[model samples]
Target: MNRVDTAVHVEGLRKRYGDTIAVDGIGFDIDPGQVFCLLGPNGAGKTTTIECLEGYRRPDAGSIRVLGLDPLADHGELRRRIGVQLQEASLPARLKVWEILKLFSVLYEREKVPWSLLDHLGLEEKRDAYFDKLSGGQKQRLFVALALINEPEVVFLDEITTGLDPRARHAIWDLIRGIKEGGATVVLSTHFMEEAEALADRVAILRAGKIVANDTPEALMRSIQRDDEVRVHVEGSLDAAAIEAIEGVATASIDGDQLIARGVGRGWIARLVNGIEAQDASLLDLSTRRASLEDVYLALTGEDEYSPESPATEEAGT
Candidate 1:
């Protein structure tokens, strides 16, 4: 990949542990100020790939460039220009949050105001609290603040919202959007399909040490051949056989007063409604479901072990 005009560039990247290959010759480039996501299931080599870019682990083969500098060769300069939040990290149990932030700030040539970062991540109240005393969500937010303390040109977040509640998850999503708006490139690694769909400008899906697919979420979803579904709750019973006989519907089933139909595309929605009306059924409520990132991931990787609600885990390398 061309290194010019890119925030991160990798080519023929490969890593291994004894006989087990963690990364197998993968390559992808991230543009400046774009939210690029590395998405895959646990043990899919997400952590290994990101760490190679962060200079934490050396790849057996391939080349990497972040901000126009080699991660391993120019470690000092690259460290100052890029921020990282690992999948797993730790701080001294006795260290107060403010102290942690202050300590990390001085390690870089340029740093953002520690307290301001705390406020931005909603960790100001925990600033005086010890690292061991903060809640899981609070601690995660503090780690995010630490990653941003350097005002990095590129930020790497690996499973940053792994165990947080819905509110906390959305807060971090907003922060990611803010990071992009501030002209910083973000490389986020996660298995959550909704999260990637919500935040990623482009997504690269990995599986078994290789990239299976890469594209915008919309484009990727469009690439797959899947049926759209429409569910309608009716006051009167709708015959499954009659609905299935509709010109555009592929299949239809009825449960209680609800009619569920899988069809070709959005255009079938209107046809189904008209068909239902002709059958003398009152449509009380209706909703349509379209192809999503999860669909694309499953179709490309053929992995169903990962779910949206499952806890996130990194590969063996950490």
Candidate 2:
């Protein structure tokens, strides 16, 4: 696609701090109204790459464009059309939710009102609450509201829902969908495998400051291996000859009383069932599951060294 048509574009972007190279040569694109998630572990350079795109940090090399403006050279123009929620952002403790929203709105060329933004985020009831008085989830919602106050064309969210409860996390997911539906492109950094699989239209897996893989979640999972697994629980012991009779059945193994058949596609499941019936083996329970994004992440990046903790987790045990 043309660079001009993309909401955010980066090419061979590099960043360094002293002797360390934080962001190596990496590149990607964010399409308009699409949720593009960047996944990586701590010290992987996801943050550095995002900061360069947001114009908060100047890159040592390469190029970046946000809404057709150079992120570093034309930051003033870009800022007018882009909203950002930094990972370390914090508001004054005494500031009321409504006041904080109103303050940030004034920074944008075109702004949405505090109440309207809060209503969209399900934070209308907390509008008058002090920033420090709000819960972790409430603060996250308010941060999101402030980011969108400018009616920006592109929104940058860094670990936005990292510390929320399951209910709150799902709520934020719905809110993110609403943002995409409102014609705004979203670029976010998240370590949550399921979160990327659920919200992102496309994902880029970053490792050591470089993008190792980029594609749809489904495609990535499928690329790992061609084999599909079927779990079958039968009333009695399964015969090896009968199991081998199923078409496309590469292998069958017994784990406790459950028999697992591995092969290609859904056809193997039916063949295995029919073969079992032919042998007079009664079927007890059957289930089929696809490879998830977690499997894909582990295959591509190895297991992450740092397990990201949510804000609530940090707060509760501290």
Candidate 3:
């Protein structure tokens, strides 16, 4: 078989369930062996889009190719080459861990030693544990093992770390990094800003069934206006325009006695400092903070990251 440079490609993709559009004219590509992250709020069509590429659902419009093959038409070949971890995954309550891994390993011609998969995902200790007996983190680890049991060329991970505690989430992150290092192209879909920032070689931020932003995490954060913030606590009043006049300063504001200066470039800090000193303003305090992916997500979606009202994501297409 010939190896392709692009692991997955989507063009003008569209899907709808009746009047509610699930995905709308979205397009992006994933490079071979790259970790591509799909980031969005719940119901932002992240999973729906991923499912199309995974061959679980056919798009209502547009085209998708995974491993250079049509996901639906070539699903048999595609399924053998791709492994998936769905968002709300669970196994039979009575099934033991090793039994499931052993079962999945045979489904594909390529195989990984069941024990090695157990050790690789830190599930060696749970070999005898029933699926229902494992904790949330343990269950997730087992799922990852099952996903990789086939030694697939491409892996689709949907919300891999959702509901995991901080410690477990970090552990899962390490496992995902290891997956990339092993030469498999990974498509990750998640609402967690930090997960995307930490794992994605490239990210496409989906909003209302369409891609609103697509870039590296750093570039996405940088694209947001007013991202660089430097707070200068002035002993006396300083005109907002005077601070804004400094090169690299995008905007200036007053918060009580503090001058809140937002910078546009790397040199914003130096310019602000020079301008303040020249104005004979004594600095009571000074601190600088840069923007992050979370800021970009909030600005793009107009939704709180920690909002409790987020609906359980229900995908429309298969």
RMSD of each: 2.9, 3.0, 3.6
Which residue pairs collide in model 2, if any? Answer: 163-311
User: What local distance difference test score does each model get?
Assistant: 0.85, 0.81, 0.82
Candidate 3, residues 192-217: lDDT per residue as tens digits? 78889999999999988999899999
> Compared with the true structure, what per-residue lDDT tens digits does model 2 show for residues 9-128?
899998889998888899888888899999877677877877888898889999888888898788887787788883433578898888887777776644455568788888889889
lDDT top scorer? 1
Poorly placed runs, candidate 1 (over 4 Å): 1-4, 86-90, 236-246, 254-256, 312-317
lDDT of 1 by residue, 149-223 (tens): 888899999888777777888999999999999999999988789889999999999998999998998999999
Once model 3 is optimally superposed onto the true structure by TM-score, how far is the C-alpha of residue 205 displaced, in angstroms?
Answer: 1.1
Candidate 1 residue-wise lDDT at 264: 95
- Where is the poorest 10-residue window by lDDT in model 3? 309-318
Taking all chains together, each candidate's TM-score versus the true structure is 0.90, 0.92, 0.84
TM-score of 3: 0.84
- The lDDT, on a scale of 0 to 1, for candidate 2 is 0.81
Output the better candidate (2/3) by TM-score: 2
